[model samples]
Each structure stands twice: as structure tokens, then as C-alpha cells.
Target: MTSQDERRAFWEERLAADWTETGVGYRALGRSFNEWMYRVRREVFLDRVGALDVDWTRARVLDVGSGTGFYVRAWQQLGAASITGSDLTEAAVARLRDHFPALRFERLDVAEPGDTFAGADFDAVSCMDVLFHITDDDRYTAAVESVARLVRPGGYFVFSENFLHRPAQRGVNQVNRPIGWITARLDRAGFDVVHRSPFLVLMNAQVDAGTLWRKAWGGVLRAATLTEPTGWLAGAALYPLERRLVRSRTESPTTEIMICRRR
Candidate 1:
């Protein structure tokens, strides 16, 4: 099947299974480490983007690949001028509309750039956790370039990539590159890198993507790893620890964040 068909199937499965049109709830609903991990991730990411101010009220914000409009509610809470959320999934958009009557939703395959963001649009734009699934390098480059073209000159393109730091991890989310390489890609794409960090541990794949029991055990391990100097020691003792060393100063940084402006 094609990529479009795959994403469509992913959303259809979610809608047939977990799409909720109620109050603000993330992709995951249960109050567990998984939910907390997502919340903390958003909190950290939002803070890193410096997008928490109330001045955002009514500011035109575009959320690309906005599954269930998770950040849509946030942009609204921060006083976004308006939020235009686009995704490849009809069921996801339908769910978002049922929840937020005022928000705008559009349908498009995220793998293609021009399918959405027609012109130099909006004050700022963002796409969280959506780039990595795009395995085609040429298409990925095109999509990033398209995002750049959509933003007004001088407008910030607030986004992040799970850089492919490890060559073997290439087929997964693009979460394995260094800041310099990533900055180069942004430069080529016409983005000006203003600020960036080495890495930040976003989530544990084995936990968030794991089963309930695995997550429970993983949470316990995570809790142990957060207890000050001991976690640092535990990380060192552990083998192939990039999963926990995200952006850790004591450990080699794993995940990173970059803030860039249109050049």
C-alpha cells in the first residue's frame, strides 16, 4: 500500500478505536506514565519554543500533521489569533471538529508539501512528532522546504525532528543527527537557526510504545533514573543508553531542539 493509504489506515484504526471528541485529551487518555510523558514533553517543548506567553492570542498558527489537534487547544489557550490544523486523516479531523467548533481543519497527505499551506501563510507554524514517519529523503526535504515556503518572511518555523543520529535508525523518525547537520539542513531549507540544544530525553520508546505491563516496569525504571546522581550512574552502567541520555549533560545528548526563523 502507499504512504497515504498507510496514514489513512492509521487514523481509521484510531477513529474506529480511540478518537474522542470531548474536552482536551491527548492521543492517550488514561492517567498513566504514558499520558504524563506526553504532557511533560509538550510542556518542555512549548517552553523551549518560548511560545507560552499570552501574547499569542489570536495569532494565526498552523499545525501541520495535527493529529487530534493536541496542540490546537494549547495555541488557543495561549491566545492564538487562530489555529489552522491540517492532517491526512479524515477521522482525526472529524474528531477535532466535534471537539473544537471554532478551529479550522483541512485534509492532506503530509508526505506531500503542496497539498496544504498554499501560500506564505500565518505568523508561526509547527509540526510535532510528524516528520520521522516520512522515510523518503527527497520527499522529506521537499516537505521541509514547503513548510519554510508557507511561513511569512521573518516568521518563525517552530518545529522539531527526531534526528537520525544512528544510521540504522534512519527508517524510523529522523532522530539521529547532530545539531550541526540539522542546522545545515535548515539552512538549505531557508531557515535561520537562532537557538538549539544538544538533546532532551523526550520519551522511552519501550515505554510509550510498550504494553501496559512493560510501561509499568519502564515507569519504575524511569523513576529510578530521575533520582539525582544515581540516575547518572545507572545510565553509565547501562549499555547503549541513548534512550535515557537525551540531552543530558552528564551523558551524551540524545534528542535536540532547534529554533529557526525564515531566512
Candidate 2:
């Protein structure tokens, strides 16, 4: 099988096993922590998108990687005129269709050759916490370009990344790319990044940090994830603090959201 097929199967198996926020998010951290992490994502996402100049209630929106239909619901809450949710894995699409029969959910692989999705240009395209999963550099470029193509000129493309200043760090399924590499890719794809803000300060992966910080953060996560109750408590205790930090910080050691306009 091709690498794309392999990646699809990998996600299919994973979502089939645990189709929850935890399944799409930090699974090792368990359900409660993952839920909290997504709560943070929701807050940051809505705050950012709500502030955009577009009138969401009249805008057509597309959410790529609609894992567990989290962002799909966000769009719905914002009263989008039309919403389409797409995922690379069949498992997610099936589940999303079942859970949200009123919405459209399709199996879409953005990196695939030619057009992967069929629709009019969207006013906003959200591919949050999804790009890094395209491990191959060529595939990543295709995905970004495809996303750019899907958005109308002057429309928004909001995504999340580590935006590392140093060299990229690759894992089995993800890559934390440097800010320069990502910006150049976006520029070539006809996107002008207008806003960069913190999404998570201490609630998720710290792929760009030093060894000591990563280890220390790992220890804290281990403690928080000891049990479901502990996870809930930890999440509750740290959530407010995390929100403050995310709001106040200009940049983060972990993941951050970037809002771009098709130029």
C-alpha cells in the first residue's frame, strides 16, 4: 500500500477503537484530559474565529480533519450558513454522518493528487491540529496548497501548529515543523498569515521545548493522567491558569493557532 493508504488505515484502526476526543487528541492522557484539552481548543478557536471580520452566520465553512466533529459543532454554534466536514479516515466520516446527519461529512484526503473535495470556495477553512500528521514533506505541501485552493480570496484559513523556531522534530505520525518552513510554504500557497496566537500553554504536546522542559511536562502529565478522576481534577485546577496564559502569551512553547487569508 502507498504511504497515504497506510496513514488512512492507521487512522481508521485508531478511530474504530476509540472514537472520542481522546481518540483524536492525546489518547495516552486518557479521556478526561483529552476532553479538557479540547475545551481549551474550543475556547481559543471560538474566540479567534468570532473576532474575524467575516459574518460567520452567512459564511460557508469547511472543517478539514473533523475528528469527532468537534470543529463541525463549533461552526454550527457560530450559525454558519453551510458546513462540510471532511476526514481522511472512513471511520471518522461514518461516525460523523451518524452523529450529525444534518451536516455533510465526506472522506477527503487533501494531499491526494487532483481535487480531493468538490464544493464551492468556502469563506473559512479550518484544519486545526491536523497538518503535522502529514509526515511527508511533499504531501504536506500538497495539503496546504489544496487548502488554499478551497478558500475564497480574502477568506480565512485557521490552523494549529507548534511553529518551532529550530529544526523540525518528527515522530511516527507527526512532525513539528519550523516556523520559517511553514511560513514559506503558506506564502507559496498564496496565504498571508495575519494572526498568530497561543492555543495551548501547558495542556498539550511541547514538541519544540528543551529536553528538561519536555521531561518535566511529561512528568506532570503522567501525574494528571494517573486516573480519570485525577485527570479531571488536574484539568480543572490548571484550566483557568492555562486560559490566562494562553490569552496573555504572545507565543507558546506548545501548539498555537495561526489565522491566514488567501491572497
Candidate 3:
């Protein structure tokens, strides 16, 4: 198999085994951080999408790379008229199908074209925390183009991706690109960016730096076996502060939440 095929297989295996461990919330000290992160992201998504403007109660929604059915559940909670989830991994699709039998689930790889949503376009498409995994250059472009094609003209596309002023790599899998490069690609795919914001600046810094403050606080929590509750309390205390900081700054965010429109 080719290198790209190998990488895809790697993700399929990892996701099938346990997907939650990929994020902070699944870790022992991640309870609060995870909760805070999801809550803020939901708020940002709703605000940027103008939830009030869209009649979600009767709108068609599609979630690409819907691992673990998180965003699928979010859309359902919003009372979407219909919801469909697509993923690259059969394991993910199978599990989601079993859990949310009422909603449709399909195995889809954004890099290649197939009958996504049965060729029916959607009012809103959400591709969150999934694009960075498309490390291959050609495949990345193809994936962007494919996602753009799924949105009707003037429809919304909301996604989160790592953005840096310069290219960087986090481990072997994540290939973070500059914001200009990503925006240029999206523009070429006929999408116009309408809103953008950092998703997790403070937590990213703390985790990346392994700062003494974070280590000490975590040590104390872990030492006392207060990992879960203490972590949650800390997250609650920092949520407002982090939210304000992320909103006020726009340069070199660890991950960016962007709301765009098909042009």
C-alpha cells in the first residue's frame, strides 16, 4: 500500500480501538478541560452560524468525519430536520449507526468522491477536527474540494483546523499549515470565510509548554487523587478567562474555528 493508505489505515485502527483518548477530556486530568472546550466550541459554532437565523428545526445537516457522533448529537440537540454523519472509518460508522439508528451514517473518505449524502447537497456542513489528518498534499486539496462540493451555494461550512503563521508538525500524523494557505485553498474551492477564532489557546499553551504552573497544579490534583473533580473545577474557573483571551487575539491560534459560505 502507499504511504497515504498506510496513514489512513493507522487512523482507522486507532479510532476503532478508542477515539476518546485522542482528546484531553478522556484523560484522567482532562475532565474540566474537555467540558470547557466543548461548551465554548458549541457556543462559537452557534454564534458564527447565526443559529437564530437558520431554522434548524427544518434544515438538512451533514457532519463529515463524525467520529464518536459528538457533532451529530449536537445537531440533533439543535432540532435539525434531518441529520447525517459520514466518516472515513467503518468502525466509527458502525458504532455511530448502532448508537444513533434513527440518524443515517455512512463510511466516506473526503479525499475521494462517492455518493456522499446520496448526491443531495446540504444546508450546513460541519467538518471539525478532521482535516489536519489529511496529511497528503493532493489528498488534502481533494478533500477540501470534495467538502466544498457538498455545500449548496450560499450554504454554511463550519470546521476547525490547526493554523499557524508557519507550517508545523505535531507528532507524525498532524500537519499544521499556515492560515493563509488554508484560506487560499478554501477560496479556490469557492468558499468565502465569514468568521474565524481560536478554539483552545490557553490549554494548548499549557499542554505544549508543560509550564511549571500547570505541572504543579496537576501534580497537586493527581497527588491528592482529585484529578477529575479538581480538573473540572479548574476548567470552570478558567473558561471565562480563556474565552475572552481567545476572542481578543487572532494570531497563531493552536486551532481555528472557521465559518464559511459556499460562493
Top-TM-score structure, candidate number:
2
RMSD of each: 7.8, 1.5, 4.0
Each model's lDDT: 0.58, 0.89, 0.73
lDDT minimum window of 10 residues, candidate 2 = 111-120
Off by over 4 Å in 3: 19-32, 168-171, 205-230, 250-252
The lDDT of model 2 is 0.89
Candidate 2 stretches greater than 4 Å from native: none
TM-score per candidate, in order? 0.70, 0.97, 0.81
Candidate no. 2 TM-score: 0.97
Q: Model 3: how large is the Cα RMSD against the reference?
A: 4.0
Model 2: per-residue Cα lDDT over 154-204, one tens digit each: 999999988998899887788889999999999999999899999998988
Better of 1 and 3 by TM-score: 3
Query: Once model 3 is optimally superposed onto the true structure by TM-score, how far is the C-alpha of residue 200 displaced, in angstroms?
Result: 2.2
In what order do the candidates fall by lDDT, top score first?
2, 3, 1
Better of 1 and 3 by lDDT: 3
Model 1: residues with Cα > 4 Å off, grouped in runs: 20-31, 51-55, 113-115, 172-181, 198-202, 206-255
From the highest TM-score down, the ranking of the candidates is 2, 3, 1
Tens digits of per-residue lDDT for model 1, 118-178: 7647777887656655655566677677778777777777765544433324433232333
Estimate, for each residue in 1-263, the C-alpha lDDT of model 3 and write its tens digit. 13666766876887777755234132455545566667776666665555436788878988998888878877877888989898888888888899998989888888885765557788889998888777777788898898888888888888988766655454466677767888889999999998787766654433222358657655654543356676677668767977787767764235678888899
